[model samples]
Target: MAGLAGAPADGVAQYRRVVVWRHGQTSWNAAGRFQGQTDIELDEVGRAQAEASARLLAALSPGRVVASDLTRARDTGEALGRLAGLPVTVDLRLRETYAGRWQGLTFAQIDEQFPEEAAGWATGDVTVVPGGGECRLDVAARVCAAVEEHLRGLPENGLLVLATHGGAARVAIASLLGLPHDRWAVMSGLANCNWSMLEEMGPEKATRGLRWRLAAHNAGSLPEPVTVQEG
Candidate 1:
């Protein structure tokens, strides 16, 4: 929303579009478990979701595929990588927020065990360190950094898809788009196998303090051109 919309600039390219994809559902997800930094694999439903969504994303012809090293994220990335004929580059920085003691606990269980922390986390409090785990800001920092590194290899008009967790995707999108930590809660969580897209606005827009523009969020389908009728 912050950058100009039109055809991409010509000549040497330094910017690229990005897709931050959330991994498909695991058994833990259906069970309402925290699963933070847990190496959970995709369940049957998750596999189905990944296969279907991969078909859709593969149409975009993504140039690079990257993912968290965790099992769930890696498997999800593999789905797309297989279709796009790209290898998934794994990075520990892209892992979900390590929720320390909260990992593997159900939402209700977390509330019963860590009442105050659960309350704060539910409100999207960036300062809340879940069970003494990484805070939202910390997650954003590392996630965006990994994304930036991958962007360097992206070609002109190329798309880089990142298969990661819900929390990681949300925080990374907010941080990369220059949204303050307090505004991060405005970004709704991504459903299983859904994705968000960001487009770099080139150096000209960066001079105006607008770097990346969010093209889509929590989307299951590719974006289409908008058509409006003049009244």
Candidate 2:
């Protein structure tokens, strides 16, 4: 809604809107296991959540639906693609952070076995490589690259949907908005099947060195107009 107001006649043509939707819940998710790049399928609740969320997302009339090649993300994207009649595009770069030795471990297990690493991660240290896996910056770079590639041919005013993982989505949004690494942790992790919205701002309106602005974060509902009184 913030991006929809005060636009020139061709304003809509100047930028594109992106919806970064986190894949629905998986069995690992329910059990608090780290699923980095595990290629897990959606559990029953995950599938149902995807179906429900897809119906809502379809109303936004997305022009493109792209997702991580991992089964959970791919399946989630496919749900929307089916409703929107768009084929889902798979991109491996959109996959979750390769969490190396931490994969398949529960949170408590990590805390017990890798106390230092777990502690750093708990503090939102973007530099922590997660059991020697990809750092947040690494994840951000690849995710942003994938999003940029998909956005290249997007039409003006069109929407692009990304069905991705929670960790990947968090870093992507922070990096795209040009937030400092320390501030990246300010954004909370997304819930299963929830999404964040971003809109590109024309040069005239963009913040210094930033191209995209967050329209919504960790959201399940569609965009709505906001009314505020100025002092």
Candidate 3:
């Protein structure tokens, strides 16, 4: 809210947008393990990715920066907030889906441990939880709530930036697009430090209802592309 000023009087304002970005590369991301609710820190390359994302976002001049309370996401948000000269707001609801017993485990490990459940998940069954993990629907509900809250508080034509994780980002995007939870597979995975922009039009415009349009993804200003090393 710090940088938000001169917002339009109409509920729908031009230039108002919501930008969503996945946090930079993390140790688990490199290793291809499930992060779930586990609080993992970003590796060295992740730090650099965060910095590069910050540089790209600085050019957009977003008004507010919001992020998941998780360390990896918070750290990424902090970097972008500094670049944009805005404060970072941590929102717990923006966290990734809880992986339950699968936390920190790689896909192969999960297959070895809970083959059936892993197979079910791969097939897009929201209720299949190998180990007490949250169902996909549960994640969708929480993410939708958080996004709704964020949208409600936004000033007309204000710009908001959110830093989050892969699972959460996918859920949020799917919900915004009014797509089925199972269709999450259709939405591409966001690259580390990759950013996406969406615009929500107010109730008076032609699109006058809550609608989100994709603006950008995997976009950054880094001189060199950030390479992701598999763990």
Candidate 4:
């Protein structure tokens, strides 16, 4: 079960955990091309990465698994679902940023072609939309919403494994923190096949929503709680 603390349907404070798992490496990712809604399947390395990572995540005993509609993300989630014995829920809203013109272009190509716009886009500027793709703000808005929607449906003491893209993972974390556009730039990008954990810190006595904390970032293993002994 996750540490997500909030008033659930039973009118009691329940806790749950969310893991934002980035899809494994893809050929486009290796080539530094912007995938953005592209249906690129995972490369051979990606399949191996997914299997290894999902095996580790199964240790957390996630209650449910959800993934983006894209093949890369779907396959990654399916890996975890198979290991955890959980059904996967697909939601298009969790899709990667719609990087219109930049979909297949490399960062260098984007910079060389649209120098001015590329800088702002790279820095997470809300107004900059590389190749008319979805801006950082738009990506955050939908990704966070989709994740929270699933979070709201889980048992108080459950874990949600979200298989998504790097950009969506970064935006979801920043947006949940209520950071402005400028601050969003400071959130580092998620590496392929890595995952971050957000824990709910709100009190059971409170009547408000859960307060999330960055428990772990870019983690390859599930952190188990342990207590020190008096030697």
Candidate 5:
């Protein structure tokens, strides 16, 4: 992530808040397949997850919805858009790292077939391009670019709901937070339809090197049930 991240600045608050939402699960995800850039639709559970998460996120008053152009992320974004009455803007830059030859392969299959390559990426090499797929740093670079561009257009106090893949979300966040490549995987993957919240802290907290605060991570839950009291 070269130009996407910057040194800590006592700069103005750029983004009010960012909700990085991972798209719901597909059969590939359930089967532990490397679903990079493959256009897999949501399964039944995935659809439910999207609907549930969308209901919860709508309460946050998201002013914008942006998502990867893939089918899984797009459908998840559509759920949020339908609920929040917003429109989804698709960006190919937000797409998951192209898995290349591993596009439709399962974890076991990759290990058995391409153990060396799988081990390299699994150990956080970040440079190892699985089956000649996009490198982790490359994914970070593009995702950061797309997300930062979207944040710039948001008004003050506006929340941006971003629907994308788990890998893309992890890379983008790690880059924006200025974390080293080796430590990027320390941030766990987001479960299907789960979300992480990043807040742009104002300059009052200048002592902190970075102004980005991870307010929430792996948050997955629907809105609380509405119960009426009879007096």
Candidate 6:
């Protein structure tokens, strides 16, 4: 409601409402592995989480669904699309930040194998990662760009949904809120199936020229009983 703006002259939708949600939990999540770019499928519980999220969004009745191309996000988006009866568009730019050599490893393992990188990240250094993986700043820039591109195409008053990963989502949130990359460590990871909302305001009211206001941040999963009732 707060993000409503005038439509663009070209009839391309201006900003209205955007919902950002993290994909459901994965097997690797419980196993404490760094799943960046690993392409793991959702486990049984994860699937249930995805279905529940779909039911929740269906109640909200969004106009469009967009998601990262990764398996976890795609699966989640598919479930939501099925429930909401909306088409799902995949965007590779929304994919999770690559962890490089740190992929599939636990925090303890990373600390043991790549001590310097681990320590740098632990200290909130945004530019450091093992091997060639993306830094927090890099992830923020690309994800912000992707969101901007998606928003530019939608009509004003449109409701849109995005399903993505934790790290990239965090970076996007920090960018939206104008927080420094170093603050990424202080922000909590988006829970599995959690939702956040943002609105794009006009230039005059925008804090950063291109106004991106966080309307709802890190909302937890929809209750199963409520979802069933809505369905």
Q: Identify the candidate with maximal TM-score.
A: 2
- Report the C-alpha displacement of residue 37, candidate 2, in angstroms: 0.7
Worst ten in a row by lDDT for model 1 = 1-10
- TM-score-sorted candidate list, best first: 2, 1, 4, 5, 6, 3
lDDT of 6 by residue, 1-231 (tens): 122222335654456777888998899998999999899988889899999878867776678888999999999999989988888989998899899889999878988998888888877788886547888888888888877787776776777888999888887887877776657677667888887878777666774566777766777543323111353
Q: By TM-score, is 2 or 4 better? A: 2
Task: Give the clash count for model 3.
Answer: 2
Top model number, lDDT: 2
Report every candidate's CA lDDT: 0.89, 0.90, 0.77, 0.84, 0.85, 0.79
Per-residue lDDT tens digits for candidate 4, residues 60-170, read 789989999999999999999999999999999889989888889998998898898888776678767768877877888898888888987778778899999998899
Give every collision pair in model 1: none
Candidates arranged by lDDT, highest first: 2, 1, 5, 4, 6, 3
Which segments of candidate 1 are over 4 A away from where they belong? 1-15, 228-231
Error of 4 at 159 (Å): 0.5
Q: Cα deviation of 22 in candidate 6 (Å)?
A: 0.9
Q: What 10-residue stretch in candidate 3 is worst by lDDT?
A: 1-10
For each of the candidates, the C-alpha root-mean-square deviation to the true structure, in angstroms, is: 3.3, 2.7, 7.9, 4.8, 7.9, 6.9
lDDT of 1 by residue, 135-190 (tens): 99999989988988998966868889999999999988988888877788898899
lDDT of 2 by residue, 1-231 (tens): 222333335423557899999999999999999999988999999999999999988988889999999999999999999999999999999999999999999999999999999999988898998988989999999999999899988997778999999999999999998888999989989999999999888776664666788988888765455565699
11, model 4: CA deviation in Å? Answer: 20
| Candidate 3 lDDT, 8-107, residue by residue in tens | 3555348558777899888889999988899999999999989977887777677788899999999999998887888998999889888889998998
Give the least accurate 10-residue stretch of model 5, judged by summed lDDT: 1-10
Pairing residues by index, what is the TM-score of model 5? 0.87
**TM-scores of the models, in the order given:** 0.91, 0.92, 0.83, 0.88, 0.87, 0.84
On lDDT, the stronger of 4 and 6 is 4
Query: How many residue pairs clash in all the candidates, one count each?
Result: 0, 0, 2, 5, 0, 2
